[model samples]
Target: MIISTRRIKQWLTFLILFVLFTLLLYQVMSFFTDMFEPDSIYKEPIGDAVKVFSDYGRQTSQATFSELVRERLLWFYEIGE
Candidate 1:
């Protein structure tokens, strides 16, 4: 059996391009899927922290930056426990 060099090169090129295309497609799909889906970690604790800060700020007339940070850290620690 005789295989032409040109034919071998063509097959190699096709295989490489196919693999690259598949990887690119996978990355694009993953990016879109993740973009559409909301992450719970941020949605839950972060959102709750924002609300707590807002309410606390209103009640105390103003919450210091350090106080807000402390509150958020405490909230996270309590959640972990």
Candidate 2:
């Protein structure tokens, strides 16, 4: 089969369109699904940011970060026995 340059260009265009269409469909589905569940359980950015800084500080100082962090979390959640 002798494939012409025009046919090759058309095939390339179709491949590009198919890929773009698939990406757009995926984005639309994700947007709708996220809107339905707007509130996420693990969405505490402020608290998480503070925790990351605290962990970094403890690691640099060679201190028992886990013990202190556990105590702090326990106090925050009132999970004392």
lDDT winner: 1
Candidate 1 local distance difference test against the native: 0.80
In order, the Cα lDDT scores of the candidates are: 0.80, 0.78
- Candidate 1: tens digits of C-alpha lDDT, residues 1-81: 999999999999999999999999999999999999866756456333544335454565477867887888898899973
Give me the candidate number with maximum TM-score: 1
Distance from true location, Cα of 22 in model 1, Å: 0.2
Backbone clashes in each candidate structure, one number apiece? Answer: 0, 0
Where is model 2 poorest over a 10-residue stretch in terms of lDDT?
A: 47-56
TM-score of each: 0.49, 0.45
Deviation of model 1 at 80, angstroms: 40
Clashing pairs in 2: none
* RMSD in Å for all candidates: 7.4, 9.5
**Alpha carbon deviation, residue 13, candidate 2 (Å):** 0.5
